[model samples]
Target: MEQKLLNSPQSEVNVIDSLFAEMVLDKALLDFRKKKIQQKIDQSLQDRNKREFLRLSEKLKDLS
Candidate 1:
């Protein structure tokens, strides 16, 4: 029982570390996607494409 108690913290730490890694990955992916969408939105403006602009705007809004 003493050994089990000592080993339990390691398991808890592993779970916490795994969750942190996942959160970092998710944030990075989200930042990448938002950057890409903004680029498209800018291009849409430069090209004077109203339809594309509105569509990309909604996509960017949905991310937030």
Candidate 2:
């Protein structure tokens, strides 16, 4: 009976289906983490830009 099940086409299909599902989940999780890290980096850059702009504006005011 075990040999017969192994030879069956359905068993092969089920194995392939499970493997594809696992690959998809792994890719999705990786993408989510990548996006989250990018957002944090962008926020840091924005903050730095704002601080530099303010500093420059203060210098211009002092010169005037």
Candidate 3:
């Protein structure tokens, strides 16, 4: 850190502002990726359930 920046209030404010912005951006990116992953997981579960249901139905039909 520069000695001049340590003595300057404006420089401190600027550093804080930049850090805050970076944190906000990181959080937003994390949220977006989380949502995408959850969507994929949900879709996979739905597909598995449908396949299971179809298999059971076929088994029932063969029993008739």
By lDDT, the best candidate is: 1
Clashing pairs in 2: none
- In model 3, which regions exceed 4 Å deviation? 1-6, 49-64
Model 2: how far residue 51 lies from native, Å: 16
Better of 1 and 2 by TM-score: 1
Tens digit per residue, CA lDDT, model 3, 10-64: 8889899999999999989877766665565566567887665555555545534
lDDT of 2 at 25: 100
Against the true structure, what is each candidate's TM-score? 0.89, 0.63, 0.65
Summarize candidate 1's per-residue lDDT along 1-64 as a digit string, tens digits.
4454546988889889999999999999999999999999999999999999999999999998
Candidate 2, residues 1-64, lDDT tens digits: the string is 4465786899899999999999999989877765665565566567787665555555545534
lDDT of 3: 0.69
**Local lDDT at 16 for model 2:** 96
State, as a TM-score between 0 and 1, how close model 2 is to the true structure: 0.63
